[model samples]
Target: MQNIIEVKDLRKEFKSHSSRSGLKGAFRDLLTRNYKVIPAVNDISFTVTKGEMVGYIGENGAGKSTSIKMLTGILNPTSGSVIVNGMNPHKEREKFVRTIGVVFGQRSNLWWDIAVQESFRLLKKVYNVPDDVYKDHMNHVIESLDIAPLLDKPVRKLSLGQRMRCELAAALLHNPPLLFLDEPTIGLDVLVKLKIREFLKEMNKKYETTVLLTTHDLTDIEALCERVVMLDEGKIIYDGKLAKLRSNWGEGKQIEFQFADIHVKKETLDPLLADLDAAWTPGNQKNVWIANVRNDEHIISEVIGRVVASNKITDLKVHEISIEDIIRNIYEEGIING
Candidate 1:
């Protein structure tokens, strides 16, 4: 497996100035300059192999977007190197961009007044894609995304979901082998989101396109990526399989057990529950009690035994921590440091 993207000690810094408060401060600012250097990406390094989909995730102000910008040649790194498709992205920006596609959910790359199909045609010219290749990609994407009916409508006239579908097709018109998707499904309905996810999955499988996806929606990551790179405060904290990240950092499973006796009292059950170390909550049902327990097998068994010994268990459920909760915990704990 060849690495489609390679980043080594990548760093990006920005200089921002503090605005003068009042007339006196403004006069002082005019006399001199005040600036502060902020490191948006702090010596991060990672790799993505061909045919691999990686989820890049972090809280706001984290360096996920900055890293993607450097990798896609939109921004030059203040230090270190970024290689995509065997080319230095910042050095050979035009050539590097030719080998990859990018879609930022907050912005549109499509021509506002032009029809969706025309925007794709213009992109084909921009990328110098051959007629046959362009046609094939267009046909595949249009059909896969079910955007044929939207082709004739002006980009600005389409709804967000409709326009997003067009934006995705436009990005792929050149059939770039690598894709940078930053919140691609953001602000879309559940149905539309599912459609986009399905199309992306099919495209990756059929074309072997390597994708780097950054999204706040954990469901998208769970569906699209097996590997994830977690960042915090401009540093990579975890870079490995999503499952392992969850298994390692994941808090634990929550167990909910329902008892046969609907009128069971907490006072009576206090003796049986006193031995377990788990937190207890009264379930919505009168006889049910929920226990938040660790992921460990022995601890879970002990908790379950205590619950069962107190009363006849009718229904039970064990739920692992969701990816959303996992990421939230990571942020709240300040687990990643530069």
Candidate 2:
């Protein structure tokens, strides 16, 4: 596969000025100003191949937005290199933007006063899409996003969820091969998120669109991306398959056991799993027990066997450590390996 996005030691810096409160200090500051250089995106490098759905994630103020701006040609980097689709995003912004679509969760790309379909039509003309191509893309987007009814409604008149659906449709209407989504599913309900995720999956498969998704929602990353690039303090920390990340940092399993509507106290099960070293807790409902079991100390089967033999377990569930947990651990431990 060809590399659609390539970044190497790409760095971006911003200057800040400090002002004093007092009159003398303020007057002195005006004559000799103080400025500081802050690196929003400092020496980060990664690549996205054609059709690859990769997650670029980090905490707030971790440079995710700054990097996206640079990639989208909204901001120029202070140093190093960024070649996206065989063009410098900053220098060749006019041509580069036509090949990609961007969606920012907090911002509106569509005209607020215009109807949803009008916004899309404007986009088609802006991108100079052909009549047949625009019709096909619009049909697919409206169906996939379930926004056929929203087409006649003005953007300001729609609800957040409805507007989001329209936002996604407008971005994909031109069928840009590269998509940059910054928290596309933010503040959306579960059903709405599911719809968006499914639409993105189908779009990627049908069009081979390379996606670079950045979001604080780990579930979005888990649902759509097999590979993830974790960012922290403006640098790449972990870039690998999600499975491998789990193998390395997915230390424990969460096992839940539900009793058969009987009086099952914690003391009864303590004897059974005394040696399992499980940090057990009671579920919200009664007759249910949840525990985190270590893989290094005991085999999962043995642990389950110990509990099942003594207690009547009507239902049991075992889940591997989730990406959310793994990410929390990585950030806390400050694991830096790319």
Using TM-score as the measure, which candidate wins? 2
TM-score of each: 0.85, 0.86
Q: Tens-digit lDDT track for model 2 on 1-338?
A: 79999999999999999787799989999799888899998898888999999999988888999999999999999998999999999999999999998899999999999898888888889999999988877887899899998889899999988998898888887888999999999999999999999999999999998999999898999899999998889888999998889889887888889988568888777777677667677876798888777875456788788878877788999987788878988999999993
lDDT value, residue 75 of candidate 2:
93
**Candidate 1 overall Cα lDDT vs. reference?**
0.87
Q: Which residue pairs clash in candidate 1?
A: none
Candidate 2 TM-score, C-alpha based: 0.86
How far out, in Å, is residue 272 in model 1?
Answer: 8.2
Cα lDDT computed for each candidate against the true fold:
0.87, 0.89
List, residue by residue over 1-338, the lDDT tens digit for candidate 1: 89999899999999999877889999999988789999999999888999999999988999888888888888999999888899998789877888888889999989999888888888889999999888877898999899999999999899999998988988888888998899999999999999999999998999999999999999999999999998988999888898887877776887888888888777776676576666776878887877776778998998888778767888999988678877877778777531
Tell me how far the alpha carbon of residue 54 in candidate 1 is from the true structure, in angstroms, after superposition.
0.3
Total clashing pairs in model 2: 0
